[model samples]
Target: MSKQRTTQPITTGTSVIGLVYDGGVMIAADTLLSYGSMAKSFNTPRLYNIEDRILLGASGEYSDLQEIVAKVKALALQETTNSMESIYVDRKLPAKSLWNYLRAVMYQKRSKMNPYWNDVVVAGWDDQADKPFLGTVDKLGTTLQENLVATGFGGYLAMPLLREKWRSDLSEGEARALLEDAMKVLFYRDCRASARIQLAKCTSDGCIVSEPYELDHSNGWNAPSMIRAAGDLDGDGGW
Candidate 1:
């Protein structure tokens, strides 16, 4: 008998989010790669800066994510070298074009029944249009653009928060605060999520990815004694 095709991923990351503010776009993802239920890598970054204008956040199989990043980087390098004058002449590919190219690649893989097993968020400044773009493509090659986007568990746990708070006039500081708050919610609720997060932004000037850092949760709310106290107050007998 012929073996059936396997669609499941071996290892994965989870809960990446992106949003657009008045001046730019921001993306965030935790640094955890899980092997099933086992927490394998505690510091695996799933967000990348592409072409100095795009910030890509990926969730799902790490190998597949790496492959997609490599493809984009290679294409960007070729475009930069072979069409340097075109780039200066404002004929280079913008963020929307890059996003569409990536979506096409993902869709082609899916049509061949060998999808990359990833959900990727692309955030960037569309220099040609002179505005920010934030969008996502899924394993099935489905794509969407919106003020906010999240993949994996973040879509469920954190998207609602963003949807409720996102505004067209949001400043960068305000948008980053909302994103961080959503990350905190994901960390508290998602078993596969971690405290360490990587954040990046794409603006008209350039893209910048901050070094990984752990969110502060030391305000005693996570303490067992606090939980017990709240439980006791609720008369649940501190079960």
Candidate 2:
């Protein structure tokens, strides 16, 4: 039997964006999962709360995303069970440890010529380091740690807005507002994106994933620039 591997990803999710705020870290993603060019699933959230204060948001192969998180959870459970009779303190995996584990996993798979085909955003508060943690790991196992991180379309469409507005002292409310704006731009530009948002936050208080909600579009799209842009697209027909 010949060994087979995933050569292409199907039923994929779109961008994920994360930023560290004053008290902790926050991440956001659209709820739409696309199958090729079709808008397939609207309620499947890409954000997963793996453990206390360890939040993961991923874009690309939805099945692979679920599989990776499940494997992590299983590994943690097994390790915890084995250590139950031991005298080691802090059995729960720290954010940095988890991030490193993921890097290893992704890299190993890539070396085998099989990859998860996902771009991930991991957010948490590193209590020992007394700082917020925000990072990204790609299908190729390349890793990045940044105060503000965006994946997929969000990296192109939303990063500028985040870079322009993010501050070290930003309040939680301010951070959320910035995400809301960035997501709206993504919805407008990224064809695979959804108006619905899945938000997660990890602070010293622990991680919380919010219910999926739609961007408030009541009157926000009535701007003169949007109207003129729409008119231009309708009027131009050189072909």
Candidate 3:
């Protein structure tokens, strides 16, 4: 008789954003990880720095991703000598190479009949050419994407807005501003998303993860304009 396998429902997150510009790549993720209808937790660190130059932003199975991050970091440390010259070498693994490495790791897990249930965005500057790079890896170990990518529930709502504003020619400043706008829209509209976000910029210099900040809600674009219009119908400016 074949052994029975128990299946567990996946616990995951929502709304991760990845973009590349002239200077480097930027990735943003909300801190909420939802388990079905329940908003299970907050303050989850979904964005991870793999080694020095590469970053991995994930949107599922918090525990599994955490394990993956730990293993990758350990492997990176093991692969490098502790000498100053080796540490200073600019010829280490690039974002694309890291992506390939992760694909293999994820695939190995899947082949074991137990997989990490998360979609991931891998972003950084390519160590060789020193250019921005971005890619997406799904729970099934499929890796693909370019320019911009998003994962989780908010992905459906957020990616279209990003693609509308994203340009290959955009400078770092423009990309940051556009991403801020996109996050605001997602926060207001995405039920599973949080108003708080963590942003990271990865360049040839290195990865810089910002302090968490709240999405600006003061920009009244999403406020009830119709209600304001109705109040104005009386011409008194009172509602």
lDDT of 1 at 136: 90
State the lDDT at 113 in candidate 3. 83
TM-score of each: 0.89, 0.93, 0.83
Cα RMSD of all models vs. native, in order, equals 3.0, 3.1, 4.3
Error of 1 at 208 (Å): 0.4
Which candidate has the highest lDDT of all? 2
Using TM-score as the measure, the top candidate is 2
Global lDDT of each candidate: 0.87, 0.88, 0.78
* Candidate 1 segments exceeding 4 Å error: 1-6, 85-91, 220-239
User: In candidate 2, how many Å is residue 206 off?
Assistant: 0.7
Comparing candidate 1 with candidate 2, which one achieves the higher TM-score?
A: 2
- Writing each residue's lDDT as its tens digit, candidate 2 over 136-215 gives 89999999999999999888899999999999999999999999999999988899999999889998889999999999
Candidate 1 vs candidate 3: which has greater TM-score?
Answer: 1
What is the Cα-based lDDT of residue 143 in candidate 2? 95
Q: If candidate 3 were superposed on the true structure by all CA atoms, what would the RMSD be? A: 4.3
Q: Kindly report which residue pairs in candidate 1 clash with one another.
A: none
Candidate 3 global TM-score: 0.83
What ranges in model 3 sit over 4 Å off? 1-10, 82-91, 219-239
